[model samples]
Target: YIDFYNNNRIHSALGYLTPAEYYQQSILQNVA
Candidate 1:
């Protein structure tokens, strides 16, 4: 499912952070 993938997919380029976590951190960084 898309939701499962978004929350669980690990990104090697992102230091293995999940897509959801990576996006969340990116947004926070951008806002800061």
Candidate 2:
């Protein structure tokens, strides 16, 4: 369930991205 929430579910607050997706994007942005 935790994995589903973080990696599979899409969140409106995160611009329709899953938490994992959002985190990855943030990390890329910070690195660049």
RMSD of each: 0.8, 0.5
lDDT of 2 by residue, 1-32 (tens): 89977999989999999999999999999999
Model 2, which residues run further than 4 Å from truth?
A: none
Q: Scored by CA lDDT, what does every candidate get?
A: 0.92, 0.95
- TM-score per candidate: 0.77, 0.89
Instruction: Report the C-alpha lDDT of model 1 over 1-32, residue by residue, as the tens digit.
Output: 99998898887988899989999999999999
lDDT of 1 at 25: 95
TM-score of 2: 0.89
Worst 10 residues of 2 by lDDT: 1-10
Error of 1 at 32 (Å): 0.8
